[model samples]
Target: MHFSRVPVRTLDTDEKSVAQFGTEKMLESAVLLADSDLDAVVTLSEEITKATGLPCSTSTLAQVEVLKKYGVKRLSLTGPYVDGPMRGLVAFYQGLGYEVLKTSQMNERNNVVFGNTPLVRIKELIREADHPDAECIVVACTNWPAALVVQEMEAELGKPIYDSVCVTLWKALGMVGVGIPLFGWGGLLQDDPILKKMEDVLEILLTCCAASRTTLRLDFLQKNCHVDTVCAEACAAGIAQLKQILVQNDLANTDIPPPKALMDVYAVRAQMLAPLVRGDEIYGWISVHQVGKTRVWTEDEIGELREAVERVNGILRTAGWI
Candidate 1:
């Protein structure tokens, strides 16, 4: 595998500027990895993929995926960040349906100081952030050399350790279809059956829906969606419009008229959307779209979609993502 590194300026508080930096710097790579835990920077994976025609992974997304693979619901977080960014990380995890039981930070803003942090101090921060109930411990920030001590920390703490750098590499390698056995880093590098089960569930959804595309859009992560098929710009716009309509009508599903944008822009003739709800909260929705020609959704087809939702919800609950 070819490897290269391009460094950017420190993150801007403004998300637009961060996105611009990502799109500009992430070109000409077979697979892109945005090495930042900030939501603004990490959430640009989809956008970067669209622009560069390459798979993209971010530090935040990689951490989340690792947690999902482990079925980790509760997290303890530590990082070399000030209170604001630390809290942002907590919120980001909570928004994704993970319980952040505790957080510890260095309260440092200097990236140079972040990198200079001693391994002993890093271990202390991880211990301070750890909660008895937290299923996993996440050490955030790619600049810090946390990866060097993750395996040791995990052994000492007796739970999974996810350092930002390690998880990013794990996801990046998987994206490029390279399976090099990574050891002495963390448990995330190992194979797990849960990941395969999640893949199979999505595959079943596509076959049951009989639609051209199926997407799972989490409300908190509006810019990114887990899709069974790549959605073009027009299809993405249509899905956004459909989501808006679902909200406006206070409906559990989008069984209403096709969004004008779906028909006019994307030639999307038929669509079905169902909310993935766990009790009172609606975290996200599953959408199936049929393009080209309009077709009425049959009762059997709708039933099959609902059944798939139930099955997915069961899997999510088991995986601690709900």
Candidate 2:
């Protein structure tokens, strides 16, 4: 909850001097942090760790961890950074094998100017950097107050947004094993634990049903119905066909005739889908698939799937995600 500022004379300073300044500041703060008896220390910049050889969590590391957790390989980046730092950020992600679909920067080198940038302008920059193929958008610069706009932008864009300040706190909390359910900042802070529990439920359902695959599709924060978690093998084509059938059947729980193309292309023989409904609204559905050969769904299997749906709905309700 406490912050210590390390004043950099200029962001455009030579790299060596900047690194030296970071190292000195980290060394000075390490003593204070250790004396304060904090559970963990989170640095806003990765340079502190690189310069001081400290074992603290950092924003850069947290952002990468979150991207990996979300299975994001392609991203669009926006920040209040000049060309040099912007290119370096792009290269850093590229070195990690992530595809940088687009990048936008404010070209501002002054730290104060970066902090004083308007929130509306930051949102505009993020939107400009976004691409249809990009899995997520990254808002860099811990000083820019990007955290305040992450939730609003994610809802507007229908994709996750990772901001530096939020991710740094996320990493720090996780390191200390604090399971605080957070909301409103971004999906990383809000939905990570919920998603983890949903995935666990899918694994249990997969084992209990003795099926080839089990998937949990939910209408997440943006009300977009997508596969949120899967257990065992997943067939994209099979899931797509199942979705079509569900739409055609009016979201009812039924064993519809499998389309010939589905069988021919993906070898999906049978599927049992139960809609996750709480009263009038149909949030999404849980599906169990039988591949390679046709098998009639037993009453017990259908019953198990229905129970799983109820469990998922309970989770969604408990997390206030419904």
Candidate 3:
């Protein structure tokens, strides 16, 4: 039922609300840090930016130095570093005047590598995402098989870990935002800038609603007739359902023309009622009007359209958007 990186432990016992200590828990445990580690971290600032080909207004050098000076060398690297700038990072580190080491991909928990790096099955979340922005990028798990390969993993990934342990540490340290330094392991000590950016993109894509949802005035639905109050309310509800579908797909801010719009059809005067079913559960809908320009759309066609809109509507309801 949870969506974020914070782990969910479903309780069978009688527990009131759960306390989320994902990051804070990690930070409470003491770890040592240093100022020179920042030097080692900065050596690759340019290298990482070059490898990523993304502009970095923030200084990763200063961030790395902070982690190096204050990071705990606890045996919590998370899983082995996989699915990153694997080869390029090795070269980048060598150029940074640092020793780059690597380790075999292991599965202390024996996780099957389904699809390389970010594994995906056929018709998987990553695949059906269809849009690149829709894919969930999980960079780490508390039980990652590579927890033992901290130094080697960082050198290999060329990015902050952002794994389960990493986020936990970041979350914990964020509670006290003093300019403290981590020596070597842990993460960026605060927010992983790259991860934060990825999260921002994901949030926009997952939560956006279509800007093109033109609410139909029951009265002016076609050319100049407005629907009565009761019918108008129902239509508004159905249109809200339509909006949910567009938002889930990140297809918000739609700019399609009237002829090519999601809900741009006109309404006139022709009527009938039909059965509407959600699984065995059924509701009812009667035709309100017809388009004067186009031929009257049949009951079957309208029924199908209603079903599509309702499917998304159900999701909106589940998401608590009644």
Candidate 4:
């Protein structure tokens, strides 16, 4: 798919002194553009999400994608916005379970100044925002020329640096199942298999570990149920399975004989469950199985499964899901 830029004039020349894009107007522009030229629309501005009362940085779809991909619960944020909007941006991420360990804003309102800020200043701001508990650093504005310095900054800081524009492109490409190689942008790009796997695992988490049977029951009791019965039952079952695995910590047919009840429920002769864990904490669990015949899980297969689960834990910790 070809990439296109749809210029949104947020303000006229006379209105340039203040940021003037209302949420209704911005959504209207996005809807109009999606109708005319794109399969999907990813807004680059964080302000829109903030103004729209979204829990996270809804202004840009890329920010949400990045948070999901990394499972970032705690973050270090650096951006180019005024004090008020900057606080709103941090609060947005916080609402999604991300704890802002530190935040550094340039306090620059003019696009020209933000775009023209020196590379050294960018590095300094990121450094100021860095914290030991932060899982990743997010350079949070699309128009601040952050992509140009992302590679060097990530290397220097010894953590991933997610620039807004690069993340938008990454999500767009993935949406179309395109695996085009990209380099020097940041850890998110470079066509990294690990990053893609992390994204895949998070998708599984969102789909599989949705909610427990107890939660569904509560919803039904409160008359707040929105999910259909079939779907809700499925989610509850999947979550129950994951919780069972978490209590066991490790389970494999090769190591221990499968219980009759477990076998009956899954209808599987061979199965392995790996916990998504960091240190001593367990976030969730994932498993692989064979349906009919007994099969052995090889060393490589088990190792890969553990790695994927660990990756999920890392992302969840960073995104504040855990």
Q: Rate the local accuracy (lDDT) of all candidates.
A: 0.65, 0.71, 0.30, 0.57
Which candidate number maximizes lDDT? 2
* lDDT per residue as tens, model 2, 1-322: 5566666544653685367456567767755665565666777345545544445777888999999988999999999887777888899999999999999888887877888889999999999999999999998888898898887787578788899998888888787876554655766775555666876777777777777677766655353334442311232222332221231121123346655665676566667777777668766777777666566666676777777777777877897876
Q: Model 1's lDDT to the true fold? A: 0.65
Candidate 2 regions exceeding 4 Å error are 13-21, 44-55, 192-322
Indicate the residue-level lDDT of 137 in model 4: 88
Residue 233 in candidate 4 has what lDDT? Answer: 16
Report the number of clashing residue pairs per model.
0, 0, 30, 10
The TM-score values for the models, in the order shown, are 0.51, 0.60, 0.20, 0.50
Estimate the TM-score for candidate 4.
Answer: 0.50
Off by over 4 Å in 3: 1-138, 145-148, 190-322
lDDT of 1 by residue, 209-297 (tens): 56655555444322223332221111221232222212112122355665577567755666777777767877666666776655667
| Model 1: number of backbone collisions | 0
Best by TM-score: 2
Model 2 gets an lDDT of 0.71
